[model samples]
Target: MANTVNIKIDGIDVSVEAGKTVLDAAKKLNIHIPTLCYHEDLCVAGNCRVCVVEQEGVNNLVASCAIPAQKGMVIHTNSHKVRNARRHVVELLLSEHNADCTKCYKNTKCELQDLASEMVINEHMFMDLVPDKNYTTDKQSPSIIKDDSKCIRCQRCVRTCHDLQHVSALGVAYKGDHMKISTFFEHPMYEVVCTNCGQCVNRCPTGALIEKNYLDEVWDAIYDEDKHVIVQTAPATRIALGEDLGMESGSIVTGKMAASLRRLGFDSVLDTDFSADLTIMEEGTELLTRLKKALVDKDTSVKLPMFTSCSPGWVKFLEHTYPDYLDNLSTCKSPQQMFGALAKTYYAEKKGLDPDKIVCVSIMPCTAKKFEANRPEMRDSGYQDVDMGLTTRELAVMIKQAGIDFQELPDEKFDSLMGESSGAAVIFGATGGVMEAALRTAYEIVTGREVPFKNLNITAVRGMEGVREANIKLENVLPAWSFLEGVELKTAVAHGLTNAHQIMEAIHKGEANYHFVEVMGCPGGCIGGGGQPIPTTPEIRRKRAEAIYREDEGMAVRKSHENPEVQQIYREFLGEPLSDKSHWLLHTHYVKRKRV
Candidate 1:
C-alpha cells in the first residue's frame, strides 16, 4: 500500500502515490511533457528545466519531473508561463548547442532538434554561445565519439554513466560557462578505464555521444567485386531492429532482417544465434571440466564461480575493475568472435573459398562488439577475423539507405552451414537467459534428463532482477560425469555493471558463494544493449524480452545440444568442445588493464 495524493492538472483530477513527481501524475493523464535531461532508466536530473510546469500560487515554475505532487495541488503543464519558460529553455539549450543538425550523426533522431521543431524555433533566441567556447571532439575510441560542441550541458550522459552504470568515465570538469563533461586527465576514451558499453550513447539526447558507425566501410566492402562479404546477425538484433524501422518494440523481424541484408547485396546473411549455441557447448564443457578439476582432482589453481564471457562490455569491465580475477572468466570467446573465427577457417575450408577473400561482418546489439572485433586477440583466423561490427541501428540505416520497405519484406531463413540456432540461443537477448540456457544443457549432461522444469523452461533464473540466484541438485548423474551425486549446484546471474560490481564485491568478501556467474554489462542484457535502439526504457526492454522468450517457446529445438548444425560442426570440424583446434580458434586470454 502507498499514500495516495490527489492533484489537479488543467482542471482534470488526478490521483497518484504520494511523493510521485508531477511528471508522473501528468503521465497518468497522457500529458506529454517534453524532456531532455530526464530518462526513465536513470536517476532524475532536473537541471535541464525543460519539463517545467506552473503550479497555482507559485510565482516561479517548477521542474515537473522533480517536483512531487501534494494534496489539492493545481498544476498547469501547458500554461502560458510554462510554455514560454519551456520555449526559452529550449532556446537556451540551442544557443550553446551547435544547431548544424543535417551534418550530425543523430540528425533527425536528436531530441533537442525535436524540441526546436515543436516550438518552431527556426533561429537562435539568444546570442550564439557555442562560439564562446573552444569545444573538442574525441573520435579516438572505436566504439563512441565524444563531441563537446553538440552537448547541451544536460548531464543525462553523466547520470547514466555514474548512477546507472557505476562507471564514472564521464564527469563535469568545470563550472558555469566552462562546465563540460570530460574523462579523467581528458584522456581519449580508448586510453581511459571506460568499458565502451555505450549506455551513455544511448541516453544522450544530442549528437554529443554517438556510436562510431562503420557504414561507409561496410558499404565499401559490399561494393568490392572480388570480396566475399558475409554478415552475422545477433540474437538480440532480430528482436529489436524492427523498432527502428517503424515496427513496434519486441517485433521479431528475423526474416525481414535476413531479406533486407540480402537486398543490400551481402554475399551471405547468417545468424549469430548459431554461434550462441556453439558458445553454450564450449562454455558448458568448460564449466564441467572446471568442476571436475576442482571437485575431483582438488586442483588448487582452478577458479570457481566461472563468469560468462559473452558480453564484451562485461569482459572489459572485469579487465579494468577486477583484473586479479581474470582466471575466473570462461575462456570461451563470445559467439560473435567464435563465428568470426569459424567464418574464416571452417567455413572457408568447407566452401573451398580462399580465406583472404572472405569478409566477415557482424550485426550486433552492442557497441562494445565493435571494440571487441578490433581487439588484437580476435585475429585468430590470421587476418582480422571480424572485419566489421555493425549495430542494429546501423543496419536500419543501411536498410533505409537501400530504400527497402522493411515491414513489406517477406521472412526468410538464415543461410545454411552456420545459420541454424535453437530456442536457447534466441533467449540470449534477455538478462538471465545465459544462466538458464547453460543450466538447461549442463544439468541434462550430468543427469541425462531434460531440466526438471516445465518444457525445459528454467523459471528460477529467468527474470529482470539485477542479481538473481538459483540452485539445482544434480541427481542420477551419468557414470562418466559422476563426481558425486546429489550435489547442489549454485549459480548466479547479474546484469548491468553496477549490479555486477555488487555481486563481485559479495564474492570477494566471501559473503556469497556460487559455482558459476553470468554477468551482462547493460541493464537487461543484450536485448537492452547500448546499440539496440534509441530511447530504450523499462517498458521497452520488457517488450523485447517478451518477444525473445516467445520466439524461444515457438522454436522446435529448445536446447543448444539438440541443434543439428552444432552436431554436424562438431562431427565435421571441431570434433569436441575445448579441443586443441577449438582452443586455437574459439578461445583466448585476457589482460589486466591499469585501474584509474
Candidate 2:
C-alpha cells in the first residue's frame, strides 16, 4: 500500500500522497485555490501568497502550494483570516502592477487578472506604487517583448529560463524594493545569449513577456491589392489552433485551419509539411552520405552524430553555447524556412508572379521562427523569403478579426504543388518525429524495403521522454549499399534545451556514440513550442501529440520519399536531393556566436 497522509480540508477528510502539497490535496476534492506564480510545469514558488489557507494550531496562514500535506492536519481554505490574507496579497501585487488590462496583451488570459476577478477585487486599497510611465520595455529581441512595468515578479519566467531550459538568460538583478528580473548587466535582450525560445513568455503570468506579434503587418499585406499574399501553416499549428477558438484541446482542425486561412484572404494556402518532407530527403541523404563516407571510404573528417537543424531555437542554442559542434549540425534549413524559400522561388515562378510582389507569411507554433525569418542569411531568394511569421495565437486573433467561425468552417484542401505532404511530415510536430521519419526513408533506401513496423509507426521514437534512443540494424541491403549489410544505425532524439544540453554533453565527452541526433527546442517538440497555446501542461501536450499521430496514420503517403509533390519539385526544378539548385534554395549554414 502507498504511504498516504490523512488531512481534513474544510472539514472533509481526504487521503493524499505523503509528499504531496496541501494545494495538491485540495485539488483532489475540487477545492478552489487561486495562484499566480504556481505552474504545473515549474517548481513550486510561494512568492505569491494567493494560495494561503488557514491551518489549525498554526500561528500564521500557510502557503498551501509550498507546504506539505501532513497527517491529521486540519485546513480551512475559505476561513475569514485566509480570505483576507489572500485578498491583501493580491491587492499589494495589483498596487505595483500596471492595471491597464484593456491595453495588456494578456488581458483575458492573464492569470493575475483572472485571480483578481476571482477574488472580487474591484478597487485597489493601497497607494499605487507603479511609476507613471517610467518602465522599461525591452523590444530588442525579434521574437519576444519584455515590459518590466507590467511584471508581477512571480519568478515563473526565471525558473523556466534557468531550470527548464538551462538557459539562464534571465535572473534576479537588484535586491529588495528595486529587485526585478534582468539579463546580464542589464544588456538588451538581443545582445545577450537568449535563444528567443519564448518559454519565458509562455510561463509569464502577465503582459511582461509576450511574442512580438506580426498581426498588423500581416493584416496590411492581406488588405493590399498589389501584394500577392500566401500563407503556409506548420504541422503543430493545425492541432493547437482550435484551442484559441473555443475548441477542446487536441482538436484536429487541419481542414478548418486551411479553410480559415483562405477565408482570411491569402492568395494561396500551403502546408509546411511539404517542406518537412523535403527536410527528411535532404537531411536523410546527408546522413547517408556521412555514414557512407565514414564506413565505406573511412573518412575521419566527417562529423558523426549529425544533428537536425529543423528547430531554429536549438540552432541558436548551439550557436551560442556549443560553437565547436557547429559542423555536426545538418545544413538543411527548417521546414518553415524551406517553405519560404520555395514559395518565393518555385511557387512564384510556376504562377509567373514576381517574387517581390509575393508576400510569404508563415503560421508557426514557435516564436523563434519570427527571429529565424529575419536572419540576414534567410534572404536567399533575392528577397526576404518569409515576409511575416505569426504565432498560433496571432493566427487565431487574425481569424477572429476576420470574423471567421473557425470551428464551423468547411473542410478545405491546400493549393497544389507545394501543398501536398506525407504522414512523415505531419509527425514533425512531436519530439523524435524527425528521427523516426529519417529512419523510415533511410532504412528503405538502403535495403529497398519498407521499415518493418506495423502501420509504419516507429513507436521506438514516439513518446514524451526528454531524451530517447533507437538503433536500426540494416539487413538485406541493396547492391548499391552492400557494405557487408550488418551495420546498426544508431540515433537519438532530445527535446527541450536542457535535454539537448545533456545529449550534447554526452556526445562531447564521448560517452554516447550515435550516427544521428534530433533536437527540438521546446518540450514535447513543436506540439509544446514556445508559441503554442497557453496553459500548456503535460496533459494538453499529450493530447496534441495524439492528434498529430492520428493525422499521420490517416494519410495515404506515410513516408517522406513517397510524397508525389516532393518528387515533382525535384523533377521540375530542384533536380534531386542535395542538388546544386536544392542546396542554393533549400539549405543554409549557421554561424558561431559568443555566449554572453
Candidate 3:
C-alpha cells in the first residue's frame, strides 16, 4: 500500500518508488510533459529546460526529468509561472533553430514545431539567431546527415553517442551559446570515427540528425522501364513496421509487407530471411572449420573468438576502434548483402534476366545497412549488388504514399527465388538470435543430432543482458568433426556497441575465453535499431522480440540447414556451404580506419 514517495502533479496525487523522477511520476498519471533532451534510452541531460515545472516552496522551477520525486512533493506542470518559463525555453530554442520547417526533412514530425504550435507562439518573442549562427551541414556520409543549424543544443544525440553507444562520435564543444556537437576536430562524419549507426538520428529531437534517405532515387529506379526492382525485407522490419503504419507495436506483418510491396509495383518481392539462413550455413561452417584447425591442426593462423560480421555498425566499430582484431571477424557478408549478391547473380540467371537491369533494394531496420550497401567490397556480384537501402520507417512512408490500406491488405507469400526461409532466419532480428541459430545448425552438423535443448530452443544465448555467455558441449560427433568431440564451445552475445566494446575489452585483456562471439550494433538487436519506429522504447523492443520468437515457433521448419530452399540451392547452384561459389558470392572483407 506504500510506495517510496508521494507526489502531487497538477492537483493529482500519485505514489511512486524512490529514485523515480518527476517525469516518471507524471507519466504514470498520464500527464504530458514536453521534452527535447529527455530520452528514455539515454542518461538524464537537463540541458534543455523545456520540461521545467513549478515546485511549491522552490525559488526556481525544476526540470521534471532531472528531479526525483520526494515525499509529499507538490508540483504544478502547467502553472502560470511554469508555462512562461517553458515558453521562454521554446522561444530561445526556436530562435536558434532553422525554423524553415517546410524545407526540412523532419517538417511535420519535428518536435519543436509541434511544441511551438501547441504553445500558440505566433509572434517572434526574440530575434532570430539562425542567420548569425553560420552553421554548416555535413552531407558527405552515405548513411546520415548532420545539420548544425536545426540543432537546439538538447544533447540527446550527445548522450546516445557517448552513453548508450560508447562511440563518442558526437560531443559538445565550446560553451554556452557558442556550444555545438562536433566529431573529433570537427571533421566530416565520413572522415571521422562515426560508425553511421544512426542511433543519434533516432534520439535527435529536431532535423539536426537524419538518415540520408534514398527514397527518391529508389522511386526513380522503380519508374524506369529498363529497371526490374526487387525488394528484400529484413527480419526485424516485419515485426516493427506496423508501429508506424497505424498498427500496434510487435505486429507481425510479414505477409502483409510482401503484399504491400507487390502492390507498390515492385518487380519482385523477396525475403531477406533466405539469405539469413544462408548466412547461418556459411557462418556456422566457418566457425566449425576454424575450430577444426585450431584444435586438431594446432594452427595459430586461425583467429579464435570469431565475431559475427552481420552487423555493419559493429564491423565499422572494429575497423575504427579495434583494427587489430579485423581477422577475428568472420568473412561472411551480412544477410542483406548476401541476398543482394544472390539477387543480381543467382536470381538473375534463374529468371533469365540481366544482372545490370536487376536493381536490389532492402527494407532493413538499420541505418548502418545504408552504409554497408555502398561499401566497394559489396560489388561481389560484379555490380553494385545492393542499389539502395531503406529503413523500416522509410518503407512505411512509401506504403502511405501509395495510398494502400495496409490494415486491410491480405497476407501474401514472397516470390519463389531467394524468397524462402527457415524459422532460424526469423530470429536474426533479436539479440543472441545469431548464436542460438548458429548452435542449432552447427551442433547438428558436427554431432549428427539436434542441439540438446528443450523444443529445439537454445535459451542460453537469448535475453536482454548487455553481454551474455553460453557454453555448449559437443558430444557424439561425426567422423569429420571428431576433433570437436568433448570440446566445450564457448560463445558470447552482445547488443549495442557499448556492450560490444566491453566484450572486446575482456577478450583483449585475456579475461574472456570464448571461441565465438555475436555482436549486434543496436540495443535489443535489430528490433531496437536506429531505423525502427520513432520512440522505440524498451517496452516496444520487448514486444517486437516476442513477435519474432512467436513467428519462429509457428514455422514448420525451424533449423537453417533444414530449409528446403537452402538444400535446393546447395544441390542446384552452390555445391555446399563455404564452397568456391558461396565464398565468391556470400563472403567479403572489412576496412580498417584510423581512429580519429
Candidate 4:
C-alpha cells in the first residue's frame, strides 16, 4: 500500500496520498483555493501567487499549489496574512488590466472577474502601473482574434498552446512589465504558424482571445418575418450546449434543446445526426470505391491512407501544415454541408418549398465551422447549402431572449427523416468517432462479415491523448490469403492542430505507415471546442466525454453502418455510394489557399 500523509486544515483531519499538494488535499475536504496560474493539465507555474496559504512553522504564507503536503502539517487556508497577500495579487493584476468589465465580453463570466468578486477586492489599491504596450490586436487570423490589452499575463494561454497543444504559437516576450503575449517576432497570428485551432481561446481566462461572434447576423435573420428559417444541430451540440445555459458539463439536453429551438420560433428543428448517418452511407461507399480503385487499378493518387474531412479545422490545418497530403483527404463534404445540400434539394422537393426562400441555419460547437460555411465549394444544391452557422453559446443566448424556461420545457423530438439517428450517428460529437464509424462500415462491406466486437467503442482511440493507434486483421476473408496478406489495416487518431503537426511530420518522414488517420482541430474534439461554453477546462471536457459515452451506451444502434435511417436514405434517393448523384451532391473537392 502507498504511504498516506495526515494533515489538518481548520480543525478537520485529512489523510491524503503522499506528495499530493495542499491545494489538492484542500479540494478533497471541500475547501476552495483561489488560483490563476495553476491549470489542472499544464505544469504548475506558481507565477501569479494568488493561492498563498498560511501553514504552521512557516515564516510566511507559501504557494499551496507548488508546496507538497508533509506528515502532520497544519494549514490555515483563509488566514489574514493569506487573504492580504491574495488581495495584493489581485490588486496588482487589476493595476495593469483593463478594468472595463461592463463593456467587456467576459463581464459576467471571466475567471478574473469571478476571482475579484470572490476575494472582495473592489479596486486596485496600489498605484496604477500602465506598462508600455506594443501588441494589441490579432485580427489577421480568420478563425481567432487576439487582444493583448485584456491579457493578465497569467500565461495560461501560453501553457495551453505550448504544453497541451504542442503548438507554441504564443510566448511571453521581453521581461517584467514589458512582458507581452505575441506571435513569432510580433507578427500577425495568420502570418505566423498559428493553426487557428482555438485551443488558446478555450484556455484564456479572460476575453483576450475569443471566437468571432456572429450572433447579430443570426438574430437579424430570426427577426425578419419574411424569411423562413430552418435550423439543424450537430450531434455534438446536444452534449456541450448545456454548459452555455449554466448546466453541468456533459448534460444530454437533446430533448430540451429541440423544445427550446421551437420556442425560438424556428420553422423546423432538424438533426445533423440525421445527415451524419447520411454521410456514413455516402462516405462508406466512397471509401470502398477508393480502395477498389487503388488496389485493383493501382491508383496511387487517390489510394491508401484516406483521411477524414469532417472537421473543418483539420481541413484547414492540412491546407496550411500538410498540403502534400491533400489527396489523402476524403472528397466527401462534412455532415453539416451534406445536410444543407440535401435540405435545399430533396427536402425542398418533398415539402414543395422553394430552396431560395428557405434559410438553412446550423448550431455548431466550433469556430472553424464559420470558415467552412463560407467556402465557395460548399454551394452544391444550386444555392448556399447553409446560410448561417451559430455557436453553442450563441444558441443559448437566443433561447434566453425568446423567454423559454429550459428546465421546465417538455422533451421533444426532431423533424421526421432528417431528425432520426442512431448511436453511431451520435458518436460524431466525440474524438475519433468519425473514424470508428467509418471503420465499422468499411470492415463489414469489404469482408462481408459482422464485426467481432458488436460494440465498436475502440477505447484505444478515444479520450484526450495526443495520439492513438489501432490495428485489425482480415483473417475472416479469403482463408487462402493469410491475415497479413494483401491488406493490413492500421489507423491513428489525433485531436488538436499541434498533434496534427507531429503526425504530419511523421508521415512526411516516412515514420508512420497507416492506412487511415482521423484528425480533429480542437484539443478534445467537438466537446471541447472553440465555440463551446466559456471557461472550458480539462475536468469539464472529461465530464462531457463521459456524457457522450453515456449517450452512445443508451443508443439503440451504436454502429453507423447499422443506422436504418441512413440505409433507407441511400436506398430511396441515391442509387448507391459514389454514384453520379451522390458524387455531385454528397461529395466535395478541396482547394489550396495562397499564403499571402
Candidate 5:
C-alpha cells in the first residue's frame, strides 16, 4: 500500500514499507531480536540495548527499534557478537535486579526471567549488587505499590504514565547506575497527581509496580463460617480471568468463572451487569430531566457535558487532574459500587440476612475499583458497601489456591434480585458502554417509542480507539423551554487518560464541545485495567473486549430500561427514576483532592 524498501537480514532479502523500523522488518522476516524496553504501544527507547543488530558497512551494532530500515541494508540479527552483547545486557540487569524469584511475587511469569531463559543465561557471573534499601517505597497509594528494588530503570512505566495515561506521577531520577524511578520530591504515589489507573503497573516489565491486593481480607472472610461471603463479578472479569487459568486470552468463561467462585466457598454469586442496568434506568432519566430543563433554560444547575461515572479511574482523574470540571461528572456510582451497595442493602433485606454479617466482595478487572470501594462517598448503604475488592488476576489465583478444576466447572447464573441484567448492562465492561447504555434508555423516553436499534449496541463507539464521536437524533418529546430545532446530540468517547486529557483540554479551550462524554482511564476500558492479568497487550486486550460484546449479543434483553428486575426495583422500592429516595440511596457527591 506504500513505498517499499528491500533489506537483507542474515542473507535473507525482505521487502518492507518505508518508515518501518528495523524491529518491524526483522519481526516480519521471523528474525529473532531480543527487546526488553521496546514495546509496540510506547515510544522507542533504546536505553536497553538488547535489540542491537549488526549491519554491513556500519560503524558498529545499531538498535533495531530506533533505527529505520534502508534500501538493500544488510542486517545481521543472529551474529555471535550480537548474542554476546544481549547476554551481557541481561546479566548486568540481573546483577542489579533482585534475583530472589522464588520469594518474589512475579516468580515464574516475569519478563526479565523469560528474557534470561531465552538467552540461555543460567546465572549472573558478576558480583551481586544489593539495591538501595533506603530508596522510598510509595505505599501511600491505595491502589498501587512501587518497589524500587525490582525496577530495572527501563523507563517503560515512566513513558506509559506520561505518554499513554497523561499522568506523569513517576519519572527517572538521578543519573547513570545510581539512577532510580521516583515521584515528585520522592513523595508517595497517592500524594502526587497519580490517578491510580494502574497503566504503569500494566506496562512494567517486572513487579516494580503492583496492585495493593485485598486477597487476604477475602480469604479471612471466606474462612469465617458466620459471615455470608458473596461475590459479584464485573463484566470484564470473565474474559481476562481466563488467562490465569491457562485458557485462551479472549475466552468467555462466564459459567466456568461462576462455578469456580461458588466452589471457593462463596454463599452466592452475583453480577455487576445487574447494577449496570439500574444505572441506565436512573442515568437515562437524569439525562432526560436535564435536557428538559436545558431546553427551557440554557443555564441549568444540573450542568452540561455530563461525563460517564462507570470508570472509577476516570472519576479520580477528574477529581485530581481536572478539578475545575468536577461538576461535569455524573452523580452515578460505577456499577461495581452500585452492585455492592445493593448487595448489602436490597439483597440482604430480601434474603432476611443482616447487612453487617454479609460480606459483599467484587471481582473486577480494575485496580481503581479497590480505591473506589474505599471512597468515603461510596458507602451510601450506611455500612461499607463493598468489604473487599479483588482483581480478575487475584480471583484466578484464589481459584488455583483452592485447587478447583476451573475447566470442568459447569456454567451457572447469578443470584436473583441483584443478578438480572441485559446486553446493555454487560457492555459496561468496555469503553463507552455506559454512554451507549444511558443513550438507549434516554432515547426511548424522549421519543416515547422503542429504540430503532433494539440491539442498542452502537458499534461506532466501541473498541480501543482513543476517541470516537457519534450523533443521535431524538424524536417526539415535549420541550420544557425554548430550544433550537434540528439539533443533534454530539457525544465523544475517550478510552485512555492520554486521550481524556486531550478531550478535556479541547473542551476547556472551546476547541470542541459535546453534550455527553465518556472517559475510561485505562486503555480498552476495564479489560486492559491495571489490575487485570499480567502481560496485557493490545492483542490480548482486544480478545477480552470481544468476549464482553459476545456476552451482550447472547443476552435476552439488551436495554437497561427493559430489565425486569430493574423495573421491579422501581416498582417496589423507588417510585420512579431520580426520585428523592433513589437519590438518597444511589447518588453521591465528589470531593476535590489536592493535586500536589
Candidate 6:
C-alpha cells in the first residue's frame, strides 16, 4: 500500500497520494484552480504564479502546482489572499502582454484569457508594458510563427523542446525583465535546428507560437474558377477534427469531415489514407528487399532496421541531430506527399484535366506537413505537388466560415479512385500503427497467411509507451525466400523525439538490434500531433487511440495489401511496388543538415 496524505482544502478534508501536489489533490475534489504554465504533458513550471493558493500558517501564498501535499495541511484555493495574488499575477501578465485578443490566433483558447475571464478582471491595474511595435516576429519557418511580444515567459516552450523532444532549439536568453525565449543567438526558427514540430505551440498557453495557416491561399484556390481544387484528408484528421468543431474528443467524424469539405466547395474530396495504404506496399516491399539481400545474398551494404519516414518532423530531426544514420531512414515519401504526387499525375490523367489546373490541398494533424509539402524534392509531378497544407484547426475555421453546421452535416463518403483505404491505414494515426500495418502485409507475403492475431489487431505494438519492442519468428516461408526460413524479425516503435533519441543511441552502441523501426515525432503519434486540437492530455490521447483502433476493428478490410484501390493503382499505373516509375514518383532521399 502507498502512503496517503490527508489534507483540507477550503474546509473539506481529502486524501491523496503522499507525493501528490496540491493542484492534483484539488482536482480530485472537483475544485477548479486556473493554471497557465501547467500542462499535463509537460513538467511542473511554477513561473506563471497563477495557480498560487494560500496555505494556513505559511508566510506567502504557495504555488500549488510546484508544492507537495502534506498530512493535516489546510489550504485555501480561493481565499481573499489567494484571489488577490492571482489577480495581481494576471494583471501583470496582461500589462506586459500584447492584449489584442480578437486578432490573436489563440483568442478564446488562451489559458491566460480564460483565467482573466474567470477572475472577473474588468480592468488592468498596471500600465501597458508591451515592447515596441518594431519587436520582431519570426515567420521564416514554413510551419510555425513566433511573436515575442505575446510571450508570457512561462518557459513551457523551452521545457517542451529541451525535455520532451531532447531537441533544445529553444531556451531562455536573458535574466529578470530582459528574459525571453529564443533560438540559438535569436536566429530565424527555420535557420536553426528546429524540427518544426508544433509540440511547443500546442503547450504554449498564448499566441506566442502558432501554426502558419494557409487558409487564405486555400480560399483563393476555391474561388478561382480556372483552378480545380481538391483536398485530401489525413487519417488522423478524421478522428480529431471533431474536437475543434465542438464535438467530443476523439470522435470519428470521417463522413462528416468529407461532407464539410465538399460544402467548402472543393472540386473533389480524396483521402490521404488511400496513399497510406500505398505507402505500406512500397515501404513493406523495401523492407523485405533489404532483408532478403542481407540474409540471402549476405550483402553487408544493405541497411537493416530501416526507420519509417512518414513523419516530416522525425525526418528533419534525423537530418539535423543524427545525420550519420540518414541511410537507415526509409526512402519512401510520406502518405501526404505520395497523394500529392499521384493527384497531379495519375488522378489528373484519369480525369482528363491538366495537372497545372489542379490545386492539391492536404488536411493534416501535423504542422510539419506544411514544411514537408514545400520541399524542393516534392515537385515530382512537374508543378508543386501539394499546393497547400491545412492543420485541423484551419479546416474547422473553414467549416465555420462557410456557415455550414458541422455537427449537422450529413455523413458523406470520399470520392472514388483515391478515397478508399483499409483498417491498417486508419490505425496509422496512433503510435506503433506503421509497424503493425507493415507486419500485417509483410508476414502475409512471406508466409502466405494472415497475421495470427485475432481480428488482425497487433496488440503488442499498440499503446502509449514511449518506446516498444516486439519480435516475431517467421515460419513456413515460401521457396523464393528460403534463407533458412526461421529468421526472427525484430521490430521497434518509438513516439516522441526523446524516446527516438534513446533508440538511436542504443543502435549506435550495438545494444539493440532490430530489422525494422517506426518513429513518430509527436507523442502518441498523429493523434497527439503538434497541429491536433489543443488541451491534449494523456487521457485524451488514450481516448483518441482507442477510437482509432475501434475504427480499424470495425473495417471490413483490415490489411493494406487487401485494399482494392491500392492494388488497382499498381496494376493500372505504377506497374509494381519499388518499380522504376514508382521510385521516381514515390521515393526521395534526404540531405544532412548542420546541427547548431
lDDT of 4 by residue, 1-596 (tens): 35888999877999889989999999999999998888886788888899989999989888999988898889999988888889988888888787778977667878888989987776569776555455377776656778887888889888887876666778889897788887778888766656566777777888888776767777777788877778999888898888777788878999999999988888878999988877777777776677667766677777557788888878876776567778888888999999999889878877778888788989988877877777889898999999887788778888877877787778899977677887777878888787777777777766766556746676777787888898877665644223324477788998877788788889889899887888887878888777788777778888888888788889888776677766776778877777788888988887664332
Candidate 5 lDDT (Cα, whole model)? 0.83
lDDT of 3 by residue, 19-52 (tens): 9999999999999999988988888989789999
For each candidate, give its TM-score against the true structure: 0.99, 0.99, 0.98, 0.90, 0.96, 0.99
Candidate 6 C-alpha lDDT tens digits along 444-545:
988898888888888999999999998998899888777738999999999999999999999999999999999999999999999898978999999899
All models: lDDT? 0.92, 0.92, 0.92, 0.80, 0.83, 0.93
Better of 2 and 4 by TM-score: 2
Count clashing residue pairs in model 5: 2
What lDDT tens digits, residue by residue, belong to model 2 across residues 198-232? 89988898899999998999989999999999899
- Stretches of model 6 off by over 4 angstroms after superposition: 131-134
Global lDDT of model 6: 0.93
Which ten-residue region of model 5 has the weakest summed lDDT? Answer: 477-486
Looking at model 6, residue 30 earns an lDDT score of 92
Backbone clash pairs for candidate 5 read 255-411, 296-481
Better structure of 3 and 4 per TM-score: 3
Q: Please list all clashing residue pairs in model 3, or write none if there are none.
A: none
lDDT of 2 at 15: 95
lDDT of 3: 0.92
lDDT of 1 by residue, 405-424 (tens): 99999999888999999999
Tell me the TM-score of model 6. 0.99
